[model samples]
Target: MTLSDTNHAATLALRALAWTLGEPARAERFLALTGLSPDVLRASAGDPSTLAAAIGFLESHEPDLVACADAIGATPQDLAEARRRLDA
Candidate 1:
């Protein structure tokens, strides 16, 4: 996948995680650490900073954050296919 696709996927993953964890604050904090904004957590939805912020947040949260990550892990390929459909 292209960088943009990866970034978008990451954003979607982040959103899925936040939803599962029920901790928007954690998600927001994660984005903030990477100097990212929470608004962009949507798929292909936000700026690079937002993605970076989320990564930073997840890094800080560690094992506690794994639950959220795992929740979305199952859907990445499916998400990619959806993106492809959108592109087509």
Candidate 2:
């Protein structure tokens, strides 16, 4: 997945969400930071706003952003750009 792909933003956000949820503590932190309950998160997983929030969550923390980007085969900038696209 190249950053330029039209669907890249949503895809990357989903992957980031999965990575965020891979660990219980991190997932709890994400939910806390985003004010999203697990049920709401599941229900809105695909919503553009929710996706953007996921990207925003990563963006707010450099370590997680870099780690998630590396884990997902994307650059930190790619994640940032994806957030921009999603926000658009």
Q: Candidate 2 — worst ten consecutive residues by lDDT sum?
A: 1-10
Alpha carbon deviation, residue 9, candidate 1 (Å) = 4.1
Alpha carbon deviation, residue 50, candidate 2 (Å): 0.5
Which portions of model 2 show Cα errors greater than 4 Å? 1-6
Clashing residue pairs, candidate 1? 30-53, 30-57, 31-53, 34-53, 36-49
Question: What lDDT, from 0 to 1, does candidate 2 have?
Answer: 0.90
lDDT of each: 0.48, 0.90
